[model samples]
Target: MDEKVVRYKKNSNDIHVLPPSPYTEVPKPNVRREKLSVENEETIQTKKKLEKTKKNFLFDPRRKTFLGRSSLNWARLAAFYTVFYFCLGMFFVILLYVFALILDREVPTYYNKDSTMAVRTTATVVGMGFRPQPMVDDSLIRVSNDLYEQKRIASSLRLYRDVYLIQKTDAKAEPCTELDPASELVPGTACSFSWFDIVSTQDHPCSDNNMYGFKHEEPCVLVKLNKVYGWTPTKGPLPIHIQGLRNIHNNKSIAKPDVYITCDGTNPSDRDAQTEMVYYSLEKPSGSSKYGVIPNYYFPYRNARDHVQPFVLVQFKNLPLHRLISITCRAWSPGIEHETRGMRGMVAFQLYRSQVAEKLIKDDN
Candidate 1:
């Protein structure tokens, strides 16, 4: 059908034109992603700031800062301590000087008669001491008659040998001279101690050959009065008021004032044991004399220079055999009465016979 229907030529513009896609413009970067990136950057900056702060806190050497300030403070504290100690030392020295000024160089601050206050309040009293005190036990004299114990006694005597020998030298000048019977008791006129007379004879109480009587059954006890600063016993007869009836009857004349020593058995049961003991040289064998323990003029100890301490050597002529006796010896003076303290100026000891001492040793073993 060749009909004249001519196909209409498709126009170039008639071809379907595609519309621009909706996502074509490369969609603007996501807004959320941009915000996330910015946040990450801020977080990193904050971490760095924290690290810097921690470093500064640990040890900052900056002037007027932590470590620097601490060092300066320690130095100031040390300087303060040094100055404080120096001032304290100076104050102590000043106080010592003041104390020294108050004290006397030659004399004691509080002593016998010199200090009236001390005399009334303090009352300086001294006791007696005995040499050859028991070495093993002070309370008991446990010397046996056996050879061993006798040797021990000899050793004790030797300890004081030098002291006894001191008399040989003139180191101690005579302090007293023989008193004239006509004159009143004088300071320098009292009879001096004759060391040779006391110790030269073999039969004497303190003879060197006898080991001061340790070898013999008889024993010599040396007694020394304790020393008190500036104290002197009055040199005169014991006041008549202080004299007992016995003393008055025995010493009717009262011409010689003397210090008497009495040794008595403390135990009533043992009193008989002391009956045989006698005080030697109490009087001249030919005539009656005053009690003799120490002479009156030897007293008033005038310092260490002019006077030597006078000691009495007591000899036990007949100590009880194989028995124990308690003996108490005392120094009697008018002003010096029995005192509760220091055994009332008395010394007491226990005397053990050889057999008793040996038995005691065996029992102890």
Candidate 2:
């Protein structure tokens, strides 16, 4: 007998049709039912989102869109950024020109202490600097009597001295004393180094031959006047008390210099132990008893091309060993401003020495 059967069509749902007779064979359906959907709402949503993103990233040739933006929109953005950066660049260039206009090539905009404002703790008044500084940002003078250290120090002193000795001044320059009125001191007049020759002075403890007195534990410290442009010192007589400390008898008739450089111990004990303190200068050699002087003639420094700053060489002797001695060296003049807090118009540092073996400080090298 004939039987009714169900058949599946791809698009339509279900149909009842005649099955194959004994004359023809039909394969059994492996799938029980059509796969309505194995994927859930989440999977469909994810696929939809990915397709949307791909469409946004793809170039739309029909719409003339690039990087997901319409050509017109892209043009607007490019124009905006170009104008923005161009204006920014122009503003920067204008600021640079303004700064250049305010600045001078000859002189600094802010000089002296003002140049260091918000950058340093040093006082506004000029302060001296020390050389042969082994450590940075430190003012300690730890000059041990060790032979090796002494030799290194002595070489350093000679190099420092020779810097001025070997210096060649401008041929156009003349003597500073010969400067006429309205002298800007350009390429300043030369001062003969021979007249100021502590470095080459014979037999002096401050001389390089004696290793600047560091050979015998009698360390010498060089003090230089802090340079202040256009400063003119008012010459005056050295105080009697300062002269007494210097162990020098001044002939009152001879005029004294304005800047009297004096170094003494800070405390009573240190002062008493300071036993032997002497002074020498490259400019005026007053027998090591008088205070070091920077003559008024060296004033009104104009930042010349060949200007040599005056320095004072101080030799210390009879100091106690293996102890720290606080020393304050100051430039005293009638009008020079000094601060109680800052070492203004002055410089301070501690001196310490260690015991050393007896060795000849002078070597052929």
Candidate 3:
């Protein structure tokens, strides 16, 4: 009933009318998101307030929420595992320290398997007249452990040398290993000693046995040296040869030298002492005995000089001089402490004076 005039427009709503076009002008809805940064301290405080409110609503313990219980269990498990791992690591560290201590004491003192012996020997040689050279195998040229050792021969007839050995026990199975004094081996492994004199006369002269004593007097000889020395073995036996006192060849008269005898050959005073060469006469037992008395020169110092030195020759004679046996010789040296070095030379004799004379005449000598 009221006066209404219709206006021409593209789109017209009875109450609100506008032109119909692709572009429409209306207030855009605001979409806001919060950001926090160090540049503005107020942003951090606002963010904290929002986080607190959301956390309280979502994770209230008194509300008995299943999500809250799951999160708490996860936290408790993580803490327990962290503490367990820490304790386990501490236990291992303590164990390793104890093991190292045990090995340090036992190895160098009790067993003769110390590698430092080699080091000390090397040092001593350098200090003296000799020079040290590293040993090396052709195949192991690039490896660190491969080395060669060489020294010049001494001018003196008596020489001293050091022997070295490397020992190892691997309880932890480390590929790189050293001696473990704390550990005991079932059979024990040892390194071979490679030091000796080029002029050594005994086949297999070992200082350890020379000082101690020969197990079998099969070819017995002893040398009581001033200082201890080591020997090396070649092939089945040592290349060294030992010559007996009876076999000593000299152009001098039949008169014997002033001989001294001592079980303690290493003692300088005793080293110069010599045994009395006593001749014993044997009598025939009226042609009744099958075995005749054979002349024997008894040298009683075979065992005493094995370890301790200055072994003296005890020369005593037995009858029946036809059968020739074995001959052995020993040496004594000068040093502060007396110790046996080793047997130096030996000879197996089966020659007759008559045979020697025939050969000499035949050769026109």
| Cα lDDT computed for each candidate against the true fold | 0.58, 0.66, 0.27
**For residues 117-190, what per-residue lDDT tens digits would candidate 2 score against the true structure?**
32554433556755545556776776765668888877876776667434464433445442442144444454
TM-score winner, 2 or 3 = 2
Query: On residues 202-230, what C-alpha lDDT tens digit does candidate 3 reach at each position?
Result: 43322233321121211112222222122
Candidate 2 achieves a global lDDT of: 0.66
The TM-scores, one per candidate, come to: 0.60, 0.63, 0.18
**Which candidate gets the maximum TM-score versus the true structure?**
2
Q: After superposition, how far is residue 7 of candidate 3 from its true place, in Å?
A: 70
Q: Model 1, residue 248: what's the lDDT? A: 56
Show where candidate 3 strays beyond 4 Å: 1-69, 105-365
The residue-by-residue lDDT of candidate 1 on 1-365, one tens digit each, is 12222233476434454555555554456899999999999999999988866666655655434533476776898899999999999999999999999987655776675555245334446577666774645766654556567667767766665654244444434545335321233333322344343454666655667766666767766666765554545444564533762445333434445556666688787787774543443232111122236665555453433234556666665676778888877777653555545475678877776653668667665
Error of 1 at 202 (Å): 4.1
